[model samples]
Target: MFRRFVAIVAFVALAAALTLVAWPQLLGLQRAPVLALAVSFRGAAAAAALAVAVVLTAVGLVLHRLRRGLGVLALLLVAFAAAEAGVLVVRGVGAPDVPVAQADDVTVLSWNTLGDSVPAQVVARAAAENRATVVALPETTEGRARQVADLLARQGSTYTVFSRSQQAGIPARSTSVLVSTALGRYREVTADGDTVGVPSVVLDPAGGQNAPRIVAVHTTAPYDLDPATWRSDLRWVAARCSERNVLIAGDFNATIDHLDGLGPAPGRLRTCRDAALATGNAAVGTWPTSMPALIGTPIDHVLATPNWRFTGFRVLSDDDAAGSDHRPVLARLRPAG
Candidate 1:
């Protein structure tokens, strides 16, 4: 019976496809083509699979001859949705309240300004409110960076600001950093290497103040840039983590799922560990304010070398109306030593 053979083949193919979507790392396809895109938004994928299952179940009830096979496929889809949802729950969809910065603690804030669509004043206010000692602004230009520094200074928080761009005077091409003088003065410096599509700001401590090297990151999104370029940018961001005593933060454009095998244990990048995962909110997404926090992509992050310990971390979704498509991420850390 050709019909029976066709049904068997269809079932096998659908199962295989769902398996890859459920866990691409099963085939090491997490970083590969379609799988990479599918895994980027686990919550969304689960919702999609569940919707399809519901539709299939309705159709199966109406068409008697196809009922059995359709019901089986529907069941398989429900299983896939459950599997994906389970991962999010395990990763944690909500973060608990984090303590505010105290003496000897450094608070870091990262916000992609969407090429300055979000004003400098809003960014300054968030930084001040968080008592952030270091701020990373991706998709923000030099001019806006200076404005943020000035606003913070007026609020009695003086910072040394540095920004870099793939091209001069282009907001979307730039990334910026502001380091509080509380830590010590810092200066803009060359990265060990370069990102292919956008700029990331790197800083070195002046006079060896024991301040960690910092990178304000901005790797291009995988869907927006060519695969090679996206991979190249991620590599550059990872390389930034390889140095000792470093603080890296901002829109990395890739999740821990994609970063697997690119680093060591509990590691999100090289020797650095993700603050969100360590603090139990790794599943809370930061991008696409249009999407729910639990359903969007958590491509933004704050990560640090082994020498630092995360005291607290959270993704701020309350600012979804703040003009940027991205939600800001905040983290507090203190020296392990």
Candidate 2:
């Protein structure tokens, strides 16, 4: 009886785990708690599924004599978990080859500097190395943004920086956009009277022809501390993406899966990570520098309208060494002709 009870409990637990992994949004748990678990599970879906499968297999082996029916049920659960894991692996396997960027391609880089622990020089060097035309920094201040631009200028690369802070003058948290002089000038786009607390700016092309309306954004992280505000902030950014030719880049604090609610159909933003996943170079994880990238949730992103084609995407390796908890994401794009 004891062995059968243990087997039943294990089977139920495994089933619940698999269900959560399969459809996280369906879970009625609190938004923040479920989202946090989903992040880890989604980042390593195959692994999570496989672990459950292994547990089920062990349970089956142990209960083969005590309850033959329970043993068969456990075996079935193992098969189910294996199938789920296979599906995840198939969807996540990256493309074998991604085309290189051309001179005509526009490159954008986004990174969260973790309260300015990364030096301006490092940021500048990374931008130059990646040939980034636009750079978005979250958790950065106006002064630091200018300092990075200055470093880039010293290296013969000129960029115009636009920054906005939540507070006027207290070294508060901020978001910044750095547009290369080569990409023409840009202006700040403000939210008229709304207070979702996300910072953004827009870049209007020189002749305003064929260039994308570039927007840099940083949404709040979804946690118990402020999940409602975080969701609202994401909705605001999503609404902005509904317009044509808008390309947004920054730390969204939510994944592609979490974006189902931010919709009105047809005008939803697409992530550059999709292209990377297709090309086998997706940054499976982009947070908490301590964990291997495959296990970390990719929160930082470069998103664009359907009119643009993503040629290449990469998450910079220098992020961990620079003391930031997030990795830098860079994407190369070309207008769909």
In candidate 2, what are the lDDT values of residues 124-234, reduced to their tens digit? 888888878889998788888899999888889999888877765543267788888777666665543222555655556655556677777787677655478777776
Each prediction's RMSD to truth: 1.5, 4.2
Query: Highest lDDT: which candidate?
Result: 1
Q: Which stretches of candidate 1 lie over 4 Å from their true place?
A: 224-226
Candidate 2 residue pairs in clash (backbone atoms < 3 Å): 94-280, 95-278, 95-279, 95-280
**Backbone collision count in every prediction?**
0, 4
Best by TM-score: 1
Range of the 10 consecutive residues with the lowest summed lDDT in candidate 1: 220-229
Look at candidate 1 and give me any clashing residue pairs: none
Off by over 4 Å in 2: 1-17, 25-36, 44-100, 168-172, 192-198, 203-209, 261-283
Which lDDT tens digits does candidate 1 get at residues 95-135? 65878666889899999999998888899999988899999
Q: Candidate 2: lDDT over CA atoms? A: 0.67
